[model samples]
Target: MDKEITIYDIAKGVGFSPTTVSRALNDHPAVNKKTKQRIYDIAAQMGYRSNLFASNLRRQHTNTIGVIVPILNSNFQSSVMAGMEKVANEAGYNLIISQSLGTMEKEIANAKTMYNSRVDGLLVSLSHDSESIEHFEPFFKKGIPVIFYDRVAEHKQSTSIVIDNVQAAYKATTHLIEQGCRNIVHITGNLKINVYTDRLKGFKYALVDNDLPYKKASVIATDLTEEAGIKAAEQILKMDPRPDGIFVANDFCAVNCMKALKQAGIAIPDDIAVVGFNNDPITRVVEPNLTTIDYPGYEMGEVAARNLTNYLDALSDVNITNTVTLRSDLIVRESSLKKKLKK
Candidate 1:
């Protein structure tokens, strides 16, 4: 059997001491970037495996972070995970990821399991129906850093990383209005979630600002799943004097809804201009590419992971109330253009 490679092997191969190799592998900023790159390359080539778990035991830390999200099968969530993994790897931390499948009961169970497993910190995106952070109270009691992203919640003990959901939604709705839409329908996620609730606020704010009637019947709330999008489309189709525009809470749902609308012979941006949130890849693939807000999921994940790791390492202090809100903007596309542009 091949010998398990260590920092010593990498050190020798890269002409650096084991301490230097170790520091480089851990991404200590003191190490010059060029040297760190060289050491990392050599370590990979020598098949050196980090003694992460053993070192964690010595330091009284699990050297692992638990990440819980609403579900695993979302383009935005997947991007967030990718960014988190990139940061975690560089920091020499392992991630224990679990999905609650959009249920609060499952989220509570996952939280319990993470607590028992002794994760040093946690990153979370709340499930659709999660109203409180009680399930994560144990982590707060233990002084474990917990960071929330996307579907975040308000808590005095934890920091949150998110985008300006209300402004983003307002921007989307206003753009649709600018393109000559009056009767706009909003298809959103469960109101229990922060992201959806904020978007709903933005939608109403936009309508009131434009002197348009704020109709409670115009808002359709659901699980934000593809199936839910199709169902929302049905509800819209049934409306008296069908809506001339739509502002969906997410791209995945928005794309599916658009497909359903198209199947029903609705001409996009003509019969009904539409705007969505989260610039997922599917936004561009749909027949008339979806107009959406660039929610910065990956950047939000990176910020959350980086903050948690920094706090764990004592490299930075995080004030729980002063949350990090990333930038978001609308990207106009053919789907929301009701008026033809001058050629």
Candidate 2:
């Protein structure tokens, strides 16, 4: 086996002190640019790969950020993770990502793992059953930064990144109403989650503003799964006066609901218009091109990661900014356009 190269080897080869070699490799500002470059050149020639574990231990920093999300399979979450990976890689930071499977117990377990790993910082999107922020206390007590994105919760010591769910949901519901939908149904996830609850508030506000009655039955809270969408469609069909439109919180669920409705002899838009959030690709492929909110998942991830890294580097303080809200816009499509276009 080839012998592992160390900073001492590079120092000897470059005729410099081992400390200087270490500083140069770590890109410390104290190291002169020219000397750092020379050290890197020599280190490469010597096959001197960094001992990140030992380096991190000495600095009390892992050079690693931990990411905890509800799930990893969804298109929106995947896009967010991709964005995070891009930013982390460019910044020379590694990421340890974990999924909670939408359960609080798993989320707590993931948090414990991250704490034990000695990550420099953490980025989290709360799980469906995550009711308390106490799971992150260890990070807080240790002064480690924690940033929340998407499905987030309020924590006095942490920063949160999110899109305007209330405004987006309002716009979606309002659009449906403008398209001649009087009795529109809202399909969403658990109300305990801030995203779903905020959207529900927006949906109700839109109804109240338009002088329409907010029927409790019109709001269907489900797991926002594909199967839930089909069940929601079935329930809607059984209503005394069928819903003329649907505003589903997730594009996946909305698309599935639309498919089920179509199978039940319903003509989309003409019979029941639909609007969804996240603007997943399925929205475009579905017949009638489902109208949706273009959620900035990737952008949100990038911003969250950049902010956390900046804080970790002591470049800025994230606590001053409690919340960072990104932009979201509705994309009009045939799925929810009930008004006929003028020829």
Error of 1 at 20 (Å): 44
| Candidate 1: tens digits of C-alpha lDDT, residues 103-181 | 8888987887677667899999998778788989988887888998988888888888888888988999999889989
The number of the candidate with the highest lDDT is 2
TM-scores of all predicted structures: 0.81, 0.82
Predicted structure 2, TM vs. truth? 0.82
Q: For residue 3, what is the lDDT in candidate 2?
A: 92
How big is the positional error of residue 188 in model 1, measured in Å on the Cα after superposition?
0.9
Instruction: Please list all clashing residue pairs in model 1, or write none if there are none.
Output: none
After aligning candidate 1 to the native by TM-score, how far in Å is the CA of 147 from where it should be? 0.7
Q: lDDT for model 1, on a 0 to 1 scale?
A: 0.87
